[model samples]
Target: MINAESQLFATNTSTLPLILIDFDQTITLQDTIGPLGKFGVNFTQNTKPWSYFVDSYLQEYKEHRKHFFDLPKGDFKAFVAQLDSYRSIERASQERLSQYKVFQGVTRQALTDQANLLRAEYLQPGVIDVLQEYKDQIRIISLNWSKDWILGFLKELELSKDCIFSNDLEFDESGKCTGNIIPTILTTGDKQVAIDTFRQQFKTIYIGDSLGDIEALIKADLGIIIGNDRSLLDSLADFGQETEQDIKKPSSLYRVDTWDQIRSLLQQHRSI
Candidate 1:
């Protein structure tokens, strides 16, 4: 079912193959943005706009608590439109929306620490093992909303450049963020573009969760849905699994709860 005519492509890899992961639910245990937004809303003295923004934003995805990590992009007006269409927003008991800016204490130290903590606790326990096991066979790539934050997380993990894609952040002279995100913040559709940019040449596979992963999941030579509920994934291919418990023990796609499952699945596919 590969879209032969589509421009999906990737560079050849003699080294480890590439992997893309959803940051929020797939890696970190919580939606990092809500906290940052909360902090921003508070930092701004609970201004109407900021508070409305926070309240409105969080309320939009209340039903998809699992998809909390998927961040939106572009201007406030556009985001407002997105909210207007979201079922969570429509179902909310109240219509009050606040535009609060919650800053998450994103100093270099705080951000770095948070990334490290996420890697240690929230990320799949055997992530390093999978990466190490496939070190020469796979590469790692990411498409996430907190591009800068993801970049920082990669840096903390010591991943090389070219292994990640995120939005650009402008910093002040003191190295603090200027409270602006790049317009091209990576989204589900953006990963296909990133793949094209790489001109990848290997038999590729992509792993992710949620509707945001539809493009990449369908584009890759092989696609895997990590959290199951594969009504969408089923349409793409036979690769879908639920492994939250395995993720708690190890990280793999073969078993249901660990990153090791991904490693095993890849190995099985490669063997075939």
Candidate 2:
């Protein structure tokens, strides 16, 4: 269920440095697998049973890719119902979810602390440097699936707001999660709307990994593929397109090896 995220401000069409970033593996060293898996384990003693349920569902979901996207828009009830209907859950999996223990001793603060530690230790070391270098020049907007997670995560990292768009999470009066996403932004390939919402005027650089990023990436003046499993950029590069140009340079479609390399490239480009 994709929901509209909170925005710090409306799009600033006045010339601004506009940079769209992917928050998961592209920025962090790891993806959501670790945190999500930990959540599963803490939920029950028989973690494997739940893992199997999720893995099997994912595999089957991938097998019928088109149908997955064919799901109705803004229909959270139907969407969740379909998702529940498709899965073949064992009794163990059902019990695990029912008794879900979101990791013992894992208060939101503890998980946040660990996430911050990872950001300092495993994230691209030069990530901050590059961002700082272009700090005054471009708006570093993050687009991601981790709605509330991204919000809380960035606050820990001390990154500025007015530069992020993610899924929306609803919280109850006690501050516990309501388990419902509102005005979902991750529903369809709606990333462009995020970019469009920013309403910035600059050479747009859209960076991401999956097909989910296709719409905005294609629309950007600069399209960067980061750790993409799908070879969507091969054809783009074959056309002698530089990041700034429409021409192709297939070999130039690089796979990031380190954060320092990213900093170097961005700094070098900014100087030109």
lDDT of 1 by residue, 101-131 (tens): 2332245455555555555555556666665
The per-candidate count of clashes, in order, stands at: 56, 17
Q: What Cα-based lDDT does every candidate model obtain?
A: 0.47, 0.48
Tens-digit lDDT track for model 2 on 1-272?
01222222213333333567777766666676456445435543544554664775566556655465555544544533444443332223333333443333233454455555455654655666666655444343333323435545454335544455654334566665443333334322445655765434345666666545544566665556665454444533433433332122332334455666556555444421
Query: What are the TM-scores, per candidate, against the unseen true structure?
Result: 0.60, 0.61
Error (Å) of candidate 2 at residue 27 is 0.3
Q: Residue 230 of model 1: what lDDT?
A: 56
Q: Which candidate leads in TM-score? A: 2
TM-score for model 2?
0.61
Task: Provide the lowest-lDDT 10-residue window in model 1.
Answer: 93-102
